[model samples]
Structure formats: structure tokens, C-alpha cells
Target chain A: MTVQEFYEEVGGDYNEIMTRLRTEERIRKFAGMFTRDESYKALVQCINDGNAEDAFRAAHTMKGMCQNMAFTRLYQSSHEITEVLRGKDLESAKQMLDVVTTDYNLVIAGIEKLLA
Target chain B: METMEKDTILIADDAELNREMIKFIFEEQYNIIEAEDGEQAINAIMENSDKICLMFLDLLMPKKSGLDVLRFMNDADYIDYIPVIMITGEATDETDEKAYEYGASDIIYKPFAPNVVMRRAKNIMELFEHRIYLERKLEKRTRQLRESREKLERNNEFLINALSSVVEFRSLESGEHIQRVKYFTQLFLKYIMKMYPQYGITNEQAILIVNASALHDIGKIAIPDSILLKPGRLTAEEFEEMKKHTIYGCELLEKFKQEDNEFYHYCYDICRHHHERHDGNGYPDQLKGDEIPIWAQIVSVVDVYDALVSKRVYKDPFAVEEAARMIMEGECGIFSPEMIDCFKLAKQELFAVTEGKFSFADVMVK
Candidate 1:
């Protein structure tokens, strides 16, 4: 899968990511790094442990990465959950978590395919 | 490990991807140094402070926050020279204000465009460079001004020396006689300035009077050699010719006058009136009592004192005690009573300075 095909599968913005990161080679290189980033795993574990503070930080970190990668769908969902978690509204944040999880997994799986 | 010709830029973030991204953006133009957390960032700054030109700090980090690093930079006094641009994904107004208060150079939001980031960093570097350049230029200008002022003062002293010694060189008298007259004049003026504030002479005014005392005998330059160099007592007619030297000194000053109004006034008064006795019997205009300017009176007393105590070709030098007695007793030429008091007050300083190594003190103030 090409970088554009990978972005299409994950519902990310290929043109916007290229504008920031510059070229297809850069996009591919960073996508491989993103696949190994454990912010998604940390977020899941912190939410399960009811650690709203750590969960907020994890979601915030992931939100940054998604924005840098132009994973638009995941960036939007994580950003919302980050706001709810920042407010310490864990119940609402937990409900919003489902949408972020779906987008995060989609991006991760797309990266795996593109890298392979 | 090769030495880099490019300036170094430090990129510090908790996220490896963020550091990598910034490095990629700037590595072509700068030597990139990466830090994984605030602690590492601080250490990197410590190791490469002389090399680092700019820092891109992530506001949130694990070991120490961006705010902590800024505080360290400010405390270390590195904030003024090294510009820091805080890059944050969660750039709230509070954090932004805190970052600036701690002296971050600028703050930019996350996912920044590479071109905008590069331009802003370059602009900040240029501003710091220009400031350093201006500071150096100002220091050099101050040094140059001080040097020129010193040179001007030296030139003034040289010209004063040449003008004052003309008569000494012509009269077959050694330069030491004029120098002793100037020293004794300064000593008397300093004491009078302290004992008698009613005379209202400032230290600057005293120095002017003292410098002009050197020219009191300049008029001797004009007397006919037959009378000026006469080895024995002068006839009344020849004595009359000798007295006109005072008038000749004033004529010479008028022909060579320059822009310094105050200095000319001091030199002119001392030259013409130094011989005027307090009892209305001395020479030229013979202005009696306080009619003589105090500075001229000062020169008059010191001239008598130096002439009395210094050995001349025809006479042996009198003792200091005898010279003091002669001036006060109205024997060597009458002087103002106030000046008689200043003369007694300066007895010790007069001895020390004339006997050669001791310096005059400026301890007196009104």
C-alpha cells in the first residue's frame, strides 16, 4: 500500500500531512515510527485503571502524534476525549473513548499494511 | 562525530516522533541535537551552551517540564543570548503566559509548518546577533572618547609648560624657581579656600589660579636685557624700565588670546597684579588692600616666599622660618592679612612638597 492508499484506509489527510512533514518518504518513515508508539496502549491501560490524570496525558500525547501524522479522524476523536478527560469527566471520557479507539486501531492497522 | 560548521539547534520533546520531526525540519541548515525529556534537555544545554543558537522546547515532558527548563535557562542567564521557541500540542493561554514569563523567546502551536518555523527561528537569531553587535560598538565608542579626552589634557599641559618657562629660560634662572612658585601658589590657595569661604574660590578656580601663577614672571621676557640681566642694584631709571614688564606680559597675552575665556582672565589678572603690594606702594597700578584679586594676592605672597627662601645669583637662600617671618612682618613686601593666615596654615605641606616627594591633598571641601 502506498502512503496515499494507507491514508485513505485510515481516514487521514494525506495532503495535509505532506504539507507538514514534506514528502512521501518522510510520511512512510514516520508512519513506521507511529506504529511502534505506545501512547494508545498507555491510554487504554490508564482508562481501565481509572487513572484519569495519566489517561488525560496519554490521550493528549496521542492527540499530538495523530495531528502531526494527519490522522484526522483519530486526531478529532482523541482531542474530544482529551478535553473530557482534562475536565475529569471520566464517565463522558470513557464513552468518547470508543470513537477514539476505533480510529486509532484503523490508523495502526493501515500503517502495518503500508509498512509490510 | 565530525565537527559541524553549522550552528547547533536543540530539539527537546518527550515524544521521539516530535523530536525526530523537528530535527528533520532543521537538520539540513543546523546541527541537530535531540533531548527525550526536560532533564536531558538541560544537560544538553549545559554541554553545548556555547554552540546552541536556538531551542525548540516541548511544553509537556516527563522528567522536567518545558517551564522548568525555561526557569533554568533564565537563572543561568542563557535566556538573553539563546532564543527558545516553545512548541506545544496543548498550548493553553495559562501555559503560554507562564512560558513567556519565564523568558521563552516565542511560543508556537503543534503541527507547525516547517517554513514558518524556520523563518521565525532565523529572525530571532538575527535580532540577538544585532543586539550583540550594537553592545560591542557602544563599548568601543566609550573607550575611544576617554582616550581622546586624555590626549587633549596632555596637549594642554605641554603648551602651558612651554609658555610658562619662556621667561625662566631667558632670565638665566633655572626652571625649578618657576616650579617652586607654582607649588607654593597651589599650597596657599588650597589653605585659603578652606580657611576663608568668604573669598568663594572653588577647587577648579584654585587650580586655574595656580596654573596661571606660572606666567606671573612672563612679563620679565620683555624687559631690556641690560636691565633684566643686570647683576647689581638697578638705578631708579632702570628700575622704572624693569617694572613695565608687567604691562608687556598683558600685551603679549592679548596678541595670542584663544577661545578659553576663563583661563585667559586668570592668566591676565595674575600677570599684571602679582607685584601690586597690599599697602599701595608696590608697582605698576599699586592697587591697595583687597582691591587686588585674591588669586593675584596668592601669587604675590608665594612669589615673595619663593624668592626669599630660594638662593639667587647675588644672595644666599634664607631659611623657611625667616622667609615666613619676613612676609608676615611686612619686610619682604606687604601681603593681605587673610593670606598671612593661609601662609601659616600651609607651613607643613609647603615644607613636604618643596622638599620633593610628598603630594598635595584635595581633602578640603566646603
Candidate 2:
């Protein structure tokens, strides 16, 4: 769908949202997040450290963000993972994480389509 | 009125009471569906590809266990991004680990508080959403990187094949001839560059020169086969016709010589005067001495040496030592005195190379 049509469907003022999101404050804040949150780069770190708990915690937080933004596919996939994590199950959590990896790609494709 | 837009959760278990109680608790807040077994759970997940946001699955059920359901989802790739909360009467680390391996999202032991269950579900859902966002960001970056890499590989292949094909059509020989020439040219260039560091050619420059050498006979493609493949000596007219390759080769290369292109001049020079004599008796316009392009001259010596030693349709292969002696003699006075001396010094090694007694890799050693 056209970006404008998508915005209309979402009941949003497309141009206004774009302007607000592109403002210096938001871009700076977004860029600053790389350093501000150690958890933001958690995927690479989790794999490196072999700490499933940390990975699970990071995934839990990211899943929450996906839900809030209505990224249903990502939210659902990652949610299954944190559920496995809370149960103190590492192997299944890793498996669920794999699912997240696949669906996460699809979510990215959708986002790119929207941006275009 | 519009639908309330509530989250949909599936509760799958063999026990009707367990399903009913969970449904009753969540029905007000979430749209609920029920499945009685692993088979039913898999079916439910498949049916609700994206609509279902959460699942409460019982550990032991008829037909298939909860772990079985998880494995099915993981294997078939049927599960959506929804969170799964596995319900069990006896939750052990072994069972939990196995379930998780199958992609169970969460585990809740039976006879637990509804509030705790609800809270865990809410937390998991929140976390699920955020994880999706960062993942999407990373995926977008990865896809962009993949596309650019593919494009680069394609362009590299296109240019290499285009350049080599020009050499291929020049004679009756297969493309393998170019491959061998390119390989040996690189080996010799690498050896000399290392042994004589004062020459100041970088590895990259050597590689480009080797690539350029692939087009050494590109102009011969325009020559008539009667002249090119003629086994016997050529008449003066045929010889004169053959000499025009240098001019044709240069003119062919000139068409691509844009001002900003770094390699154009190198290519143009090599194509035009590779056949020029050091004493000024060779080619379309032989200026002689140090006037010949060094790259062309370098190629000329190697090309003639290889051509002499290799078996052709018309002539038997010359002995490597004989070929080396002929190159050293410089019958046409086409090569410089210094190059002839270099050929003499390197003759044994070149002989070994042509006789298949030395490897291309061995030749590359400084």
C-alpha cells in the first residue's frame, strides 16, 4: 500500500508524525541509544558471552517494544522466547530465538515497505 | 461498533475444566480459543497465522504433548510471533529445557494464582514487542548489506568475463589458454616485484597489470584466421597484415579511455606498442628503445616465450631451453638488451615452468 494510505489506515497524521520523528531531538536520542543502553547491543554480546539469561532479558525488553508499536509478528515470536527464559529453560529459549530471527526479517521487510 | 481489538490467546489442554477456567479469566480481556491436544494446538496455530497473540498450552494432552506442539511449531515454522505459556502440573528442569528447545515461550506450573499467570503473560507480551523492533532494525541492515555484496560480485564477474572473452575469440584456443596465461603472468609479476623491491609496483598494481595482460591478444580477434593460424611462414603481405593488430588493438582500447579512468592509459599504451622493436624496425609505428610501453614490452617477452613452447595445431612444441635461447637471442631486436639479459638470468626458471617441472606457485616464490 502507498505510505500515505497506510498512515490514513493507522489513523495518523502522516506528515506531522514524520516531522516529529525526524526532528533533531529524536534522531539524536535514537543515535544516543547505541551507547546509553548496554542492552541495545545485547544480541552480539549475548552470543559472545554465552549468557542465555542476559540474552533472554534483552529479548524480553525488545519484545515489549514491538508490541507497543504494533509489530505483531515480532512481538509474538519474541514473547515465546522470554516465556521460555522465565522458566529457566535455555535451550528452548534459543530455539524460540531462532524463530524470532526468521520472523524478525519479515517484520523488517514490512517496515521497509511502509517507509517507502 | 468496531471490534474491541483485544489480543487473541489460545488455551490448549486435554482437560475441559482447565481450558474453561483460563478462558473465563481471559475472555473479558482477550479473545480466547481452545484446543484439546497437540494436534489441535498445531492446527489452531496454523489456522490463526497472525491473529493469535498468545497461547496457554498444557504439558500433557491427548494425541500430542505440549512439547510435541512446540516441536511442531519450531519444525514446520507454523508459530506466529505469539508468546506461549506452557502449563504443567509437574514442571522439572528437564521438561522445561526440552519444551524450551521446542520453542515454548514460557512455563507455568499448575495450581498457580491467576494474577501471577496474568502478570507473566503481560510482561512476556511487552518484552515480545520490543524484541521484535530491534530485530527488524538489524534485519533491514543485513538485507541492505546482502544486496550490495551481490551487486559487487555481479559487476566483478561481468568485467572479468567481458575482458577475457575478448581474448578468447582471438584464436582457435579455448578460454583455458587465457587462464594459464593469467596465472603464470601473475606468478612472474609477483616473483620479480618481491625480488626487486626497487621497482615500486604494489600488489594491486601487479594484479591490474595481470588483468590487462589477459587482453594482450585482444586485437588479434580482428585479424583473419588465415593469417593468425597459418602454420608456415607468412608472405611479406601477410606479415604486414598481421602487424596491423597492434594498431587495431590500440584503437579498440581507445574507445574506452575516459579521462577519469586510472587504468585507461596503461591499457592504451600496452595495446598499441607491445610489438614495437627496441631497435625501431617493428610494427605500425615503431619509435624504438625506451619509447615502448614497459607493460607492453613485459607482455611481449612473456607472450612470445609461452607461444613458442606450447603445442599448437600446426607446430610441435619447442623445447623449453630452446624457447628460452630464442627469446634471449632477440632475433627481431624487438626487446631491449636489458630484457634479454633478464630473460637469460631467468631462463632456467622459465624453462622449468614451461616443461611442467615447476608449479605456478613455485614460480611465484621470490
TM-score for chain B of each model, two decimals: 0.70, 0.53
- Per-residue accuracy of model 1 over B176-285 as CA lDDT, tens digit each: 67677777887887788788889898987877777788888888888888888888778999989888888888998989786578888888888899899999998789
Kindly give the stretch of ten consecutive residues in candidate 2 chain B with the minimal lDDT sum: B357-366
Q: lDDT tens string, model 2, B93-210?
A: 9988987877777888654555667889889877776676667788889999999987975676457657767656556565555555666566556555756576677876776677
Candidate 2, A1-116: lDDT as tens digits: 55445434433334543343434333223222322333325743674576766676566555544432334555577678767766767777666667777766554444444544
**Model 1, range A43-89, lDDT digits (tens) per residue?**
88988899988888788888888878888889999999989888988
The parts of candidate 2 lying over 4 Å away from their true place are A1-116, B1-158, B161-163, B166-170, B195-198, B332-334, B341-349, B357-366
lDDT of 2 at A111: 43
lDDT of model 2 at position B92:
75
DockQ of each: 0.53, 0.02
Chain B TM-score, candidate 2? 0.53
Number of colliding residue pairs in each model: 0, 26
